[model samples]
Target: MREVFWQLVRFGITGGLATLLYAIVYWPIATYAQKTWPLANSATWPVAANLLGYLAAMLSGYVMHSKWSFRGHGRRDNLARTGGRFFLVSLVSLGMNTFFVWLLTGPMHGPTWWPLVPIVFFTPLITFGLNRLWVFA
Candidate 1:
């Protein structure tokens, strides 16, 4: 129980860092894409930008999670296997985040920035569960 508590703490710290990295990469690229293709605001532009940002952060997140967050909790003998798991979880989470953004900003006609609400909040919690139960476990 204490271990789970400490692991969650590490996950929060690492997740926060990765989320910041994601926002930094996302805003500029997403802004540019939105500008370049205003008509595609409903999906293409945002999804692409989110994918790019997610991938960038996933790399750093994996290292932090492996070396710090879930350190000593699992076997790190083969990073390839572990990396595959991490990447799979991240990809799924990316798809989820992209869809939520589209739903909020496009169909729902919410504030353009409103998508960040789900991205910054829900997606991390979902990913953390997956990482804790599957990826890092």
Candidate 2:
């Protein structure tokens, strides 16, 4: 239980850092891509940007999570295998984020930020479980 608590704490910090990394990479490309590309709009471009961010964060987070967050429990030796698993999990998470954003903006006609609500609050929790139990396990 104590270990779980500590791990969560570490995950939060690592996730926070990853989130920052994500935003840094997301906004600029999103800003530019929207102008240059036809399909890229404020609503949808951000989703593509978020996917880029997701990929970057996944690489960064895997290193941190292995070395810092879940250091003691998991075998970090097989980075290729571990990273592949993590990427698979992230692929699902990304799909969910993209779908929700598209649904909110395209069909529901919800606020732009509405898509972010689930991406921010919900995705991490789910991914954390996947990372902890499966990816890093």
Candidate 3:
């Protein structure tokens, strides 16, 4: 349907912006940590940094989604419910991203880009459905 198409478009744009924000924040911190600390070989820190960045970006995305994407859908009025749903879904998405990245990087012997690809491709789609049906609905 047209509604779903438009929703996907809006969600894509918002998700892209949020991810850009997260990368901007994450890269600098990750770079600093790698450079400043002696644990240059450690991969876990970047994962943690990514999680923090995602959380920050998710907050911005939630506000944008409430005002733009789900506006007038009768889902934006309940601040408490909206906030809770956003946080819950965001956390779950983060967990999924982490698990996926690990699976790709470890089990599949995939390239580093492989992990990032799924996060961008899949997480937003899943998050949008959750927002529309449970959070904002």
Candidate 4:
């Protein structure tokens, strides 16, 4: 129980850092793309920026989770297998984030920042579950 609690705490800290990084990369890029692009659909450019932000977060998140967050909680016998599973989990997160962005910005006609609600609150929970049960375990 204590270990799980500590793991969750560490995960939260690391995840928060990664989320900050994502926002730093995402907001500016989305703003710039929207300003520069001359597309009919405004959501398209922001979606691309979202992908770039996810990639940045995914890389740092994996390293932090593996090295600090999930340390001593799972096997480390095979880097290739662990990395592949981590990447898969990240893809799941990416899909969720992308869907939220699309739903908010495309059909709903919300601002780019609107997607951050789900991205910050919802997506982390799902990714944490997958990381704890499958990716790290």
Q: Score candidate 1 by lDDT.
A: 0.83
TM-score between model 3 and native:
0.83
Error of 2 at 70 (Å): 0.8
Where in model 4 is the C-alpha error above 4 Å?
39-41
Task: Give the range of the ten consecutive residues with the poorest summed lDDT in model 4.
Answer: 34-43
What is the clash count of model 2? 0
- Residue-by-residue lDDT tens digits, candidate 2, 1-137: 99888988998898889867876776676567767876745666767877898888878987888888887877778879888998898788878877876787668977555666787678888888998899888
Worst 10 residues of 3 by lDDT: 38-47
Query: Lowest lDDT 10-mer window, candidate 2?
Result: 111-120
Alpha carbon lDDT of residue 81, candidate 1?
A: 84
Q: List the residue pairs that clash in candidate 2.
A: none
TM-score, one value per model: 0.88, 0.82, 0.83, 0.95
Which has the better TM-score: candidate 1, or candidate 3?
1
Kindly indicate the candidate among 3 and 4 with the higher TM-score: 4
TM-score between model 4 and native: 0.95
Model 1 per-residue lDDT tens digits across residues 44-77: 6666777888888999999899999998787878
Give RMSD (Å) of candidate 2 vs. truth. 2.5
- Whole-model alpha-carbon lDDT for candidate 4: 0.91
- What's the lDDT for residue 17 in model 2? 90
lDDT tens digits, residues 33-135, model 3?
Answer: 6667765664654576677778888889988888877766655566888798889999988888778766765677664456567777888888989988888
User: Model 3, stretches more than 4 Å misplaced?
Assistant: 28-32, 105-113
